[model samples]
Structures are given as structure tokens and as C-alpha cells.
Target: MPKPFKIPQSVLVVIYTPAWDVLLIRRTEADPSAPAFWQSVTGSKDTLDEPWEQTAAREVLEETGLDCTPGSALAPHLHDWGLENIYNIYPRWRHRYARGVTHNLERVFGVQVPDGSVVTLNPREHTDYQWLPYDAAADACFSPSNAEAILQLPHYAKQRLGTAA
Candidate 1:
């Protein structure tokens, strides 16, 4: 018999507004079989051939339909939180991960955008979206590990941008 397919480990991009508001989406909960969850732009790293940054940019575009080039600087307001989290794949998603490989390490990144940049969602990956105050966004997340990343956003902004709070 063939072995089950393992979900690829991935990166989670926390796209935000200049003021630090986070972009979140309410995943379709109509399916009673799946957990109700809200989250930001996230996807798996491609074959190791690509650089990690490329993986990040690729995910941002694939999930949000926003093409962010490697050359575009994240308006001096953005930051990168050197935070990493490991969480178990949801029971319903376990088939994506290798047998016995239950958890994934997700690296967090912050991308600052203009307050009202129109977002184009790839309907297949998400149902609805919203721009929420960081705290509110964090609270709405189904994953505590993800929430922790959001909460640490400001600190990273300050440290990386060298700005006074």
C-alpha cells in the first residue's frame, strides 16, 4: 500500500497596515466538519530550490492575489518578528502531513501596506477578509501560536525600524 502524503512545512505572512492593523479573513465555517478559524496570508514553501524569501513572496501572492516583488521595499514602516512557532496540524488536515509528523514550524513575517489597499482573494483559499486592529485580529485567530506572532508585531517594528514608542 502507498504511504499517505505529508503536508509541506510553511511560512505565515502577517500582512498589516502602516498603523500595525492586521489583515485577517474569516475562513468559511459553513462546513460543520471543519473548525471555525480566522487567519492571515499563509502557504507552504516550495521546493528547496527557491530561497525562503522567495517562498514568502510567493505565498503572499498566491493566497492574497497581491504580487509583491522581491525588490519592493516594505514601506519603512514594516518589520520582521524573529518569532517561530510550531503547531500540530488540525485533525482534519492531518492527511497533509507525514504520518507521525504532526506539527509544523511556521516563521512569521510582517508586511506593511497602505491603509486601504484593495485585496484580491483567491476564492479557493479563503471565503472573506477584513482589516482589523492588531489586538482584535489576534483575538479572532483560532491558533494561539498565530496570535502570539501578531502580538509581537509592534516590538519587531520598533526594534527593526529603530523607532521610539
Candidate 2:
């Protein structure tokens, strides 16, 4: 089947806990022998027809098996940092975009849930998942852009928690 014009736009939702720990999913590497790598729940906008918030919620449900409305209150903590990061799309996923498109614009969001909430993950996209301290989560990511966004979580958490910044 012919691919649709690559939509370089996307959203990156960092599901986390009150303690600044974020969820990480291990993606299967291209090399069959290579070990999987970690990442957040990220995906491109669905055909530019769906709203970005819809895309975020749909991805969350599809990747983690949680039914989340576009702006549902999973917890009291919710944040839109208005942070955008651009980076080269991984070679394996580059095919999803238009030809010659290298970088993708990722909008950042944070959704906090109870510390040990169980998650149901889609096996095809991720092999395993973990909730790690923000710093550790950042280090675990394969993409520098994702790491930088993870590092910014504390500030957003504070704002959402109403803690003294």
C-alpha cells in the first residue's frame, strides 16, 4: 500500500507519578539480536484530521490499554509545558513520514497517576514498561530530545502539585 504524505507533527505524553517518576516503554530494536530500548508513549498525529489532544489520548489507550479522554483527570496532576522538541526520527520510523523528512516536532504533556498503577501495554509496540525517577527515565531514553523533555518534568510537576517552585 502506498504511504500517505508523512505528517511530521506528533505528541509525546510522559505518564508519571507524584514523586517525579515517569513511565518508560522498551521498544524492540531493528536488529533481531539487539536488546530493546526505552522510550515514552509517543506517536504522530493521526492524518491531521484528529485533534492533537485526541491523538494523545488515543495513543495512551492504544499503547497502555487505558481509556483516557482528551482532558480527563486521571489524577489532580496535569500539565502542558508548551515545550517542543525536534529531532531526527528514528530510521525504523522514518518511513512513516514523507520522503526526506528527517526531524519531527513533538509536543510535550504530562499525566500523573498513582505511584504503582498497573498498565496494559500493546506487545507489538513495546516489550516492557517501567516507572522511573525523572532523572533515571531521562537517562534511559535512546533519544536525547526525549531525555531533555523528561528532565523538565519536575518543574511542571511542581506547578501542577502547587508546590513552591
Number of the predicted model whose TM-score against the real structure is largest: 2
Count of backbone collisions within predicted model 2 = 1
Top-scoring candidate (lDDT): 2
Q: What is the lDDT of candidate 1?
A: 0.73
Superposed Cα deviation of residue 7, candidate 1 (Å): 4.7
lDDT by residue (15-34, candidate 1, tens digit) is 88768889887655336576
Displacement of the residue 152 alpha carbon in candidate 1, Å: 0.7
Which residue pairs of candidate 2 clash?
Answer: 6-98
Candidate lDDT values, in order: 0.73, 0.79
TM-score of 2: 0.86
Q: How displaced is residue 74 in candidate 2, in Å?
A: 1.6
Q: Looking at model 1, report the run of 10 residues with the lowest lDDT sum.
A: 71-80
Candidate 1 total steric clashes: 5
